[model samples]
Target: MTLLTIFSQSGKYLLLSIFAFLLISCSESSPPALTTTADSIYFGGTIITLNDAQPSAEAVAIKDGKIIAVGRYADIEKSHKSAETRLIDLHGKTLIPGFIDGHSHFSEVGAQTVLANLLPPPDGSVKNIADLQKTMRDFIATSPIVKKHGVAIGMNYDDSQLAEHRHPTRHDLDAISTELPIMVSHQSGHFGALNSKALEKVGITADSIAPDGGVIRREADGKTPNGVLEENAFFGVVYKMFPAFTPDEIAAQLQASEKIYLANGFTTIQDGKTTKDNLKLLMAMSEAGTLKADVVSYPDIVTFGDDPLLQSPLMSRHYKNHLRMGGVKLTLDGSPQGKTGWFTVPYFKVPEGQPETYAGYPAFSDEKLNEWILLAYKNNWQVLGHCSGDAAVEQFINAVRNAQKIYPGTNHRPVIIHGHFIRADQVPAIKELGIFVSAFPLHTFNWGDWHRESVVGPERAENISPTGWFLTQDVPFSIHSDAPVIFPDSMKLIGTAVNRTTRSGYVLGAEHRLEPLAALKAMTLSAAYQHFEEATKGSIEVGKLADFVVLAENPLTKTRANLKQIRVLETIKEGKSVYRSTEDEK
Candidate 1:
């Protein structure tokens, strides 16, 4: 690596949040001189540098937001130690590059965290209609949080697996609260379960049939929409019905989301999918310099047409060589568990108990989806499609092929997130087309049992979200937690990727297990590559940003069984200690 010559400040590094909560970054116009050098840098534990050239070290030096050196205690002590330096000895805790959450729904996840944590509707727990009625009564009976806003809003209910195995209709909701409107989003976010009042508010009725890649799931006998609005239908309702959130609420949600990531040692987060408005708030915060976490927000494809940022100052910023703007995101299909995702073949055989062989719904026509894909690629904004089913994955891959014909680049790494059910044959296209994949490794723990039984069935479940399989095929890949969807802990993610064991101890595709070293790369460097941020923050290398975490135990030296038990002790960003374990008992 080309090591740059830069001076660093010599003193104690303090976090902005510690005192009255002030913020300052390493750079602007001309970064303040780093000549006031700190001496004898140490973390009191193992530092597992992700840099392949020099894998482990005892200490790291930082100046001007860039790493000055990474090596052993004796060597660093001999050359860099001085009288005016501040040192942090972690008492033999593990250290590594700060983990990055490659994909997440920041706004939606934030909102969900604020709501009740009740199991989503269409859930197996709602054993019968009475159970569903009880839930509805409860959601309405409470004094509304935003009563002036005029709608009872709740989210993530999967009513499909219930004994009745159906969603609540307008009539059912009318029986409870006819005066106040009610709109509850399904677990998949593809559909909405509403009441008569809400339907009236949105002007949707049995006569209102879906126009595009949407469906109003209806009753077989009356043909009235059972209040299940899929794809376009759900987005349509939420976009209009729900009240806008205040800036403080937005910040609160973001802060709450960050706490979850910090405990997991993740200093960086890719807001996997967001709107231009959300992106604007982040930019305003960063420019005002209020943003704490390094965020990479990839706006949905719709923004490339109306408000393209290829030329904006925010799109091209480098915060202490930390945060960045990489590309655009596209929603291709609905959730597989919701039985709406497009599949080349019909979903697995559901017993008489389950309704239809439902996979999920797609958001666009094959032609329109393809056209949008080509447009995003041509515009120089790398595209990331949320395609999970085999057919949906095929659709995305086909779009990539189409885009390459007219416009092509070697580093263009358009990807498909949550490709949990793509076929084995498509593995070659990832390498041939230079596309990347940031898959959900945590799926092994959360839905491992469901995939084994209800979702994909047994035989094919072995092929689901196989990251290790991609490595064997020489396809570039990384692992992630779709954050509010799964806990955002890198160790937990690594465990899921390397262990493949479910809660019941049944290992899925044992041959697909990865080694600890390989899993680490997927969490760090490979993740940076997906976001086009490999040059700045992925690995702990000379001239790279000094962003890393201190752990309680060295992950590289431990076995897979102990990975999940590890905890993040401190998170350092740009030579400054941003987060430390306040709960650490002396």
Candidate 2:
């Protein structure tokens, strides 16, 4: 046959073979070529996997975004190394499973950046009257936006502390523009200040009763609204004034926060609270391949409690790549420090209120809280309830207990997040209920002093956020920074956990000091395990996700203080170098 005829015959056979192979492989085990093969081998560094048996390693092999080999360099070479394999020598740097920040606000952090640039608050430290005057000036500059409905008002007032030390009163905001409405949120998000015009816009007056899960501040005479909105009450004001950002704008912001997260060494993050709009934005970004950070978004269920998505369909699943839709996050109570949370006992220090006998409020009734937990547990959703104070903790525990009674043998990993100011007595109950905890231990270090003087008295402050209590009780718990609120740099978390020092450099709880390895585990495998992804990632092990970080120093061998100084050299995701400090993006 001629060369042309021979080529034609060969092509026909190749086509037939391709069709046959596709059919056979679709019904059988993975094909040899399709099965991952390594392109790179990391052959140096102290690899810490958080797996107890093999806590450290000398090498790892990456192929198809998964680790095919993990062991000593010689061992990995025997099973996985190739002749043309790209080699990375870590030069004795520390390597561990990439940091997993269990709670963060990447979307909101971006929003905060934008708002801060567009609006400036008066320097709060400059005496009370001066600060108010500064606020008035800033409000005028932003008041022009009132031309657009729901003008952006109250972007700068901190409601926690003031001469009156309350939410910026409508009376004060009236000085800005009564003709145009305005609403400002508290830095804590627990409260909000509305201008007189905005209050009328929302139809909230002194006679307007507080909603079931919300509160409205009123003057002592109960004759007029004080302009402060709390919990669910503030939602209307925020949503009314909330400006919608475009998809591209949201993508840009998400990317920026992703960079911040990755730079600080967090490979994964869970948005503890998100809105439907935020969820839509994430969906848009994921479809466009713009979402770089691994996120498990759990939006607020309480706001939309009647939605079937929250009850029967407890945990929603997303395509497994980067962004995921986690279980719904509900804040049962407000911050303990803010004194808005529901507690069994009254707050240590009550703000200006009608009665001493009144315990702080809860958004959901006990019956409703129980109903929500039961429905979530029944649907097998992970309930990450934001409960910080002892009273809120107890309410959460009771709700969980009631859920168990209603539906037995439900292995729900209901997490009592924050665990702030929890007493030792609460642990046994929390453990008995089989709830997981993700403690914010850094608060013990970062805000311990402020917590000492104001929230919980200094004498009792040492008892706040005790990680050791959970440890001693064998609780299945993880620790995290409520990032944006506090950045989740693993080193800072470690420094805080091991030192138990406040931001002011005062050591608060010496007894609560955890080992360095313990802190690393919390940020890695422990966090991964919390999300039930331990089998796939969270460790430098054979047959797991090829996700690990190359560091400039070994945190394990270095001095305790050096843990804070350790730096990430490179970040690898799915065997690909996704980010590098010195090199250009490939």
Candidate 3:
């Protein structure tokens, strides 16, 4: 063969060898392609992603409880085209991220189901003391659940709404049951009333001194505790009164409570004030695989002081089987509506027993609060503080500032709960302190009229919650129901945030009203962020959990007045329907 012919043959072999080497390298080094098949594809609904990058989508593809793709319906349909994929038609509904309750008492909300509901208007029609007594009597007569137990309990009784315009005392509760120990919890859960029998049964007598940060209201003699217990005092006694529920009983209550939350579109809910017993119960429920929605609890820091459980590495944000112990919960003060919240100014209509100069007292002193804050900081624990009054807000701000100075980190994400009376001046400080505010906007509607006229005076009451102030300050804030204080009604909550209207139809803090989308964020992405589960749970983004709520209408397009009217058609958790409304579309 000629030289040219030999060279051509060599080139062919060399090229072939190079091609073979390239193929081998590609096969060995490249990552395997991700599975494109999806378990479900939701379409034909207006999807509010709550994701800034892609705020709206027509379709979402989910697989193994995660969002795999979100885009136009045609695009998702074309890519995941297959017969096995379950297609969900929204039926002209609107879908948004599953709500995350910023702060609430999950267990308490469930307990309300079994307890006599003494709530005033809207939730229950307890017009006066007589109505409350009658309700309790009726429950006692009818409920086998309560009748089976030795003691009797009723919940969510609000004095402010009573026609008598006062708290139900032992005399009132005695009307329900003097034979069996009877107790009625104030709507705020910061105060409660016990009958003479209950007071005696619990060993609280005239000789018993009030515990620190609590009060046992006295009679004219200044010796008799007239059945009223405030703050720590009430909690201490009531906790002991709780019957030992079996694990199954506890699980059943949890499921019942979660149903309410799920109906309102919450994927993650919180128990804002948990005790040691509650912690154990929650852990048991978690271990038993009974919790349906994600639950994050915050045990009372004062009660759990220096406990090994609080100090455990396990307590630092552990989520398993949809249950987590987020951190410690502290009460700087009590509830404003209950007139026990520490405030800078005196209440407009002070109770009969209180001095005109009496401002509600703090649950802990500045030094004690500082110590607790330091403990949380040192242990790298998130703190959720209940601070409804301005004074309490100030104390919280100082404690947080001091804590950060000692151990600084922007990622602490410590939260201020309630903030019902958060002052305009304090708004900037909250922003500067880098803390999150979970305001009780539901207070605006449930008790706004009463607050303006009775609790805090019109001027201060108008500014209650102050969501818009947080917005202007560019601080992270979200709206909450403080459930059992009010229902975990997300539509009602967002509507109240947007409307700031009271039950009496008065526009309160109109300036403080949030925009529709902003209100939605408070319940969705913003709330998830407060709980430190934003990345995994909040918003309808790819790779996030397939958790969403199907609404009858898009909140953004609806009129402000109609926001609350937008019903939750269905609540989807991990692409499975957890709640579906039985009522016809309104």
> Which candidate achieves the best TM-score against the true structure?
3
Residue pairs with backbone overlap in model 3: none
How would you encode candidate 2's per-residue C-alpha lDDT over 93-157 as one tens digit per residue? 76788888767676776665444221212223422434754655564566433333445544444
Best by lDDT: 3
lDDT, candidate 3, 220-269, per-residue tens: 89999889999989988987676566666766777789999998999889
Deviation (Å) of 470 in candidate 1: 0.7
RMSD to the hidden true structure, all candidates: 11.5, 10.4, 4.6
Better of 2 and 3 by lDDT: 3
Provide the lowest-lDDT 10-residue window in model 3. 310-319
Models 1 onward score TM values of: 0.86, 0.83, 0.92
lDDT by residue (269-378, candidate 1, tens digit) is: 78866765666666666666665678877777654564746456555435533345767788888776676777766667553334575555577778998778877766
In model 3, the Cα lDDT at residue 151 comes to 77
Question: Which is better, 1 or 2, measured by TM-score?
Answer: 1
The predicted structure with the larger TM-score, 2 or 3, is 3
**Higher-scoring candidate on TM-score, 1 or 3:** 3
- Candidate 3 residue 63 C-alpha distance from true site, Å: 1.5
